[model samples]
Target: MNATTVLRAVGGLLALSLSQQLAAQEVPPSLAELSLEALSNTKVTSVSKRSELLTDAAASVYVITSEAIRRSGYATLPEALRLAPNLQVARVDARNYAITARGFNSAFENKLLVLIDGRSVYTPLFSGVFWDAQDVILEDIERVEVISGPGGTLWGANAVNGVINIITKAAGATQGVLAAASVNGDQRVGTIRFGGRIGKGRFRAYTKTLTLDDLQRESGAVSLTGMQRSQVGARADWERPDGASTLQGDAYTGALHQQGTADIKIAGANLLARHTVRISGGTELSAQAYWDFTERNQPNAFIEHLNTVEAQAQAATLLGASHRLVVGAGYRHAFDRLQNGVGFGFLPAKLDMHWGNIFVQNEFDLTPEVRLIGGAKLEHNNYTGWEFLPTLRLAWNPTASSLLWSAASRTVRAPSRIDRDFYSPSNPPLVGGERRYNIAGGPNFQSEVAVVAELGYRLNLLSDFTYSATAFYSIYDRLRTLEPNQAGAGSVFLNRASGRTKGVEMWADWRVTPALRMSAGAVAQQVRTRLDPDSRDASGTTGLATGDPSSYWKLRTAYDIALGHSIDLLVRHYGKLTRPAVPAYTTADVNYLWRIYPNLELSLSGTNLFEARHAEYGGAPNRTLSGRAVGMKLLWQPK
Candidate 1:
């Protein structure tokens, strides 16, 4: 359908507080003030692998609350990430995104790590996320914790750039029926959730679906981007005096349009269980385990099936009341199988791989106002053996509302299946020559490594105004490159590239009144890369840099008129991209919501308001600029 035709059929559509100190209050607070109260009180779990105040986090971090998600009318995780202005998020297609931290944004960027609860979403097949498959019910999300710098020491490999931790609400918190539905020019989405008591534990279940139309081609024709997905999940949690346990799982199926047909099909399911023990002497222990199964089929292209299982445990304890020690270890095994096409295939059609890692971190109290944190992680995998990541952080609190911190870390991005044993027939062999072209995997490809240093400042300008700024520098080595084989016969993946990236991010939040809040963020980075000298390799190797934007700035304003009614607006601008040259663009997103009844809500939201459409990345088969969009939503819940 055309743009006018689609809009005629339906219309659409559719912030966070970080607080420093939360003193106890005698009486209860109102719903409207809960966010502000929690912003100052919300403890974050991603920064240090332990619960700590948001203002005390040594890294450049931000949190997106569920209320913010509902107010902004964000239907997807990627769209929700836009609230964190520090991230470089670009729409590649109707269902694809190029997301990264600092720089180095690409279709398969490996420097960033993403997780849901504690499950890694980065695929081992390509070391990148399949955004289409990383779906979750937006309404069930409790918060998203984002760190803009290295987290390898606490997380693991592929955390060289940043880390995103998606945390869901406890089953007990979602104790009623909740449903939401929305429609726009390009898509329709619906979600339903129910929660209640089951035996001695709380249980919840949710189902969601989305149907998307083809992205509008620059030619005004519909591109082959239509897609559909259905997902369902459930969770159960139990608590006692000394312990708590949780079990959750999800399954989903999806289809994507391709070559005039919705031939790409995908399905997956996963189950996880975790238990926490509140030990005496100010100590805590936790254990978790999970298994995942997935499959994908594309007629004539390739077929893939993967199964993975993993387990981990962590313990945190006090050391003489002056030091805090935390330690953890984990193991993972993946059974990966795939059938290759002419141009695509895994060398060993079916293979099994293992990964194991251990990490330890400690926080030392140098004095009443100063703290020093040090940690290290040792990871081993089939592809890269014995990767060591280490980090050190120092923080000083000069006053009750001011913090000074600096950190240094080392991280790595291990090689993936595609980097090894990837064979593609170049062309028809010479009339009488035996297969003139050969490009294969190297038996000795090394992992990519990076060293990063960062310094940041945080303070409360006034009782209601908070500001933060962070500066970081990173050095990379042993990056991926194409190396010629003996006698210039063919090429293999090698490590012969080096680069550097430096950037700064700053943002501020101001609560002008009880119902009005404004926030703004700005980030800038420059990347320089070159091939290592004295190496026999192809000329002009691809550096670690991809289509990275050099500068970004955004502003967000939110105003709430009633308990569940608000108006929000966001304006953003990104610097021009390189190496295919997507022009810089500016856009605004607006949302308005009204609680028509005690348990019913209606919302109107618009995105990409400046022009008909704008391109953020380049060179994808079905690539299309996302046009201006407006949609509406209805949310209902039992009182």
Candidate 2:
């Protein structure tokens, strides 16, 4: 159906749901209320496998609270990621995004790891994320925790550059009804949530759809086609006298039209279960398991089917007063099948792989204010036998509001099917004629590794001002490169290059008054690589594929007045990027909300308000937003 048709259908559902609600109910809490909750309980788990304060966390971690998500009107995870100035997010198409942290940003980038709840979303086929395939009910999200550096020692491979953890709210907290819809020209989005209680437990169910408008090329031709997606998900939480458990699952389907390629269709479903039991004082044990099924089909490109199952167990205990310990182990099995196309395909067509890892971490307190942290992980996989990653950290708290910390860690990016089995090429050249060009995988490829070190300082400079600064340096080895084969017939992937990347970033939060709050951040990074004397990089981007945007900055201002009214403003700027040389650009976005009734809120939001059209990524399709846009949403929460 067309966007308008879907809009009508969703509108009908919204009206039906609203008609059953009370005339007036409690208003949704304001930003201040949400921010206060986050500050008191905004836990960071991805950094150390245990929850801790964001400032006390020994990494460049940032949290995007639910209020931030609501005010941004991003509509998608990729768009919302732009809030973290340390991340590099670029739109490649209406439905595709290139996102990374540190550097090495590309549509097919694989150096970043993403998780939803406790489930890893990175695909085994390419060891990268298909941004389009990742979806969630934004309204159900509690916070997005971002760690902008290596986490291999604790989180495993693919955490080379950064780690993103998308955490959803508990079912009990979302008990109510909600509907949000917005219109930006031809782009439209609608999501409905209904939550209630089952016996003594709580449950929530949600369904959402997205439709995007296509952009026009400079020549008046369409650059990219519009896209559509439908998704449904549900979650339930139960707490007994002895233990607590959660069951959640989701299903999604979507279709997309590429500029020149055959249309693509995707569908997937997953179920996850997590259980926790309190053992003793300050001690807990937990178990988690999940199964995921996904399929992607392109008329002429290729078809991929994947089934994954994972199980893990973890424990956290206070080993005496001065020592705390956290330990965990996990096993993952993936069965994937790929059908070749004229474009790219894996050699085996079908494969089964298993991944296993075990980890242990010890937090030792040298004194009341000095702490030493040490951890290590041992992982085994098909491509890489046994990989050991270790980390060392130290933190010194000299005052109640100041912290100084430093860490050193080792990480690796294990090879995937894409690196060792992929093959494809344009039409072959006539007979022996040098073969126009062939791109094949390297059977001898090895896993890429890096050693990273970081230093950080955080302080509350004033009663209302707080800030954090972190600087990192990393050295990479066995980086991927496109090199000629010994036969000189075609090029193959090889580990023949190395490089160094370093950056410094800072974020500040200020509360000017009881009703006004602002947060600002900026980041700068530089990446450089050198090829071996005998190696030649066909794309030339080998030395710079990290596609460093050089720098970026963002500012967010939120002001709340009497009643439930509030205004949020955001200004974001991106620096120039090389490799294709994209000019710098800036965008301004704002959202205004009015609580017409205690149960209903009306919102007006504008995105890309500073430009007619601006490109964020270079090359194919030249993705961009078309003109300034305005939209509205209805946020209804029944008492």
Candidate 3:
């Protein structure tokens, strides 16, 4: 169906659902209500790259809302991610982080995909995220949707293990000058935002700045390396009541200046626009487009630039009482410009990708107690001509407050510039050469595919307790692998023959009383790769053994007391590995927040609380000690 048709459908559905909810609220019962529960019903879009309820989705999903962000007292996006067990987020240094899901803990973790709003941040230089480049006014975040398994169908490439979507509130959400600042031993951060309406549209603008001191080495002495950054962003939204349509746009730009062991300076910007139209009867259509640009320069005389442009349009409609059909097509174009001091030739390339797919899912309400879901995506990309992904799901609700679900799906991760045409420097100095060389790319590369099966159960045992558990197994094929060249100058990129990834994730939230709450979550994973006998790199080291490990663990817990105060603890453990170099270690962090008043808040938090004093399992010699620092923050909202 067309966008107009979908809009009419969604218009009807929204009227029905809203009216239903209003009727239910007419006779307000004298029950209990908590501030946190007021907004728990907020809609989320990252689960399937579509809107859905937190309780209705079959996959493992967690949300950290703005209120939660305020209550948790976190200073950055990574800090908030620590609360979710399905994510393994660790700080490698003052400006670097090792974040992944299930396993594969490394400085350049390629398995996970991260997005700010709908703009993908994974770099083309390395198939990983430059965490330091992602900066936002934390308080302005509407919600963070974290999905702990492969989301390749909806998100496409690099979403092999998980997807993290950071959604910010529309311009209308903030209508006044809001300011927050924090200061710690080695860190200082500030945020200021102002928003209002213009005629029929709402607009919000914000600016953020941060300065952090370098982390101390394992030797327990103060380090002189530090980082400084500044950022500015703006968002605007317009809703036309006549046709029930919404128009939204956002722009963000930031620059970083750092004096670390390796001096570096970088700047980037992203501009995005989206339009959503509600249809007549439970159908909708949305279109979005974005442009991202990044430029970086290193003191050692290396310079790089990247520009990416993407556009997509999707339509969703109801086939009947039990079926939902969605169709979409997307296009992406990326240009890379690199200037390297190393002996490799200066290579500049452009990559173009186009994908089209249609998915049909059935939410069959069988016998009023059971439901069945079946869907598929027929996708075509430039690298991989055509790909098919199918999913089957069954959900049984034996009781009103509990659900049991099982699902199986096939997903694919398409090739990217980083996988097919990347050239960069490697740390380990060549055994015989003064400077090491590292370049990876493959024109004959193929897309990575996976067959995933999952079993999950969720229960609201009591009004005070809710728990969820999920087990997943994924069979992988054509996985990306890096091999050194026999010429001894760079690395070769190719797909592995076969592999397997399995894991379990569990989480729970309990309200000891109306004023006291506790939450805990954990995830454990095992990954194995079956390499081809002929798979060898220039160094003659098997890529399979140096990749993600066979075991990994992540755990998180938080306690919120009745007196408008809370405390949280997080721990992550990476299992032992022999191929990748480095030993296993557990990193822990602690945070506390105090709500001084309804409009004022204060907090003090410390990460790397355990001070593991170790390095990541990846290839690097930097002694990463847990950052031990205390910080205080203040926030005010004028009514």
The residue-by-residue lDDT of candidate 3 on 443-555, one tens digit each, is 77888777889999877654667777899998888866677665566677787467777878888776666545566776667777667777763342334334544455555
Model 1 residue 435 distance off true place after TM-score fit, in angstroms: 6.6
- lDDT (10s digit) by residue, model 1, range 1-639: 999877755533110110111122121222235445357567899987778888888889988888778778778888899988789899877887889888878878788999999898888877889898888888788999989999999888999899989999889989899999998668799999999999999999999999888786655667676789999999999988888999999999999887654469999999999999988897889999999998988766678899999999999888887899999999999999988776656777888988899999999999999999999999999987899999999999999888999999999998888787566552425645554336766668888899999999998764477888999999999888877765446677788888899989999888778778888999989988778894566634454274577899999988877555689998999988776577899999898987655566788999899988888776433357888999999998866
What lDDT does candidate 2 reach at residue 31? 69
Model 3 vs. true fold: TM: 0.83
Best by TM-score: 2
Candidates' C-alpha lDDT: 0.83, 0.83, 0.68
lDDT for predicted candidate 1 compared with the true structure: 0.83
Clashing residue pairs in all predictions, respectively, total: 13, 2, 18
Report the lDDT tens digits of candidate 2 across residue range 338-446.
8878766787888998889999999999998989999999999998789988999999998977889999999999999888887775345565666434887888999
By TM-score: ranked, best first: 2, 1, 3
| Candidate 3 stretches greater than 4 Å from native | 1-42, 219-225, 240-262, 299-301, 343-363, 423-440, 484-491, 537-588, 612-621
**After superposition, candidate 1 runs with Cα above 4 Å error:** 1-37, 219-221, 260-262, 426-438, 461-463, 534-546, 562-564, 620-622
lDDT of candidate 2 vs native?
0.83
Candidate 1: deviation at residue 304, Å?
0.8
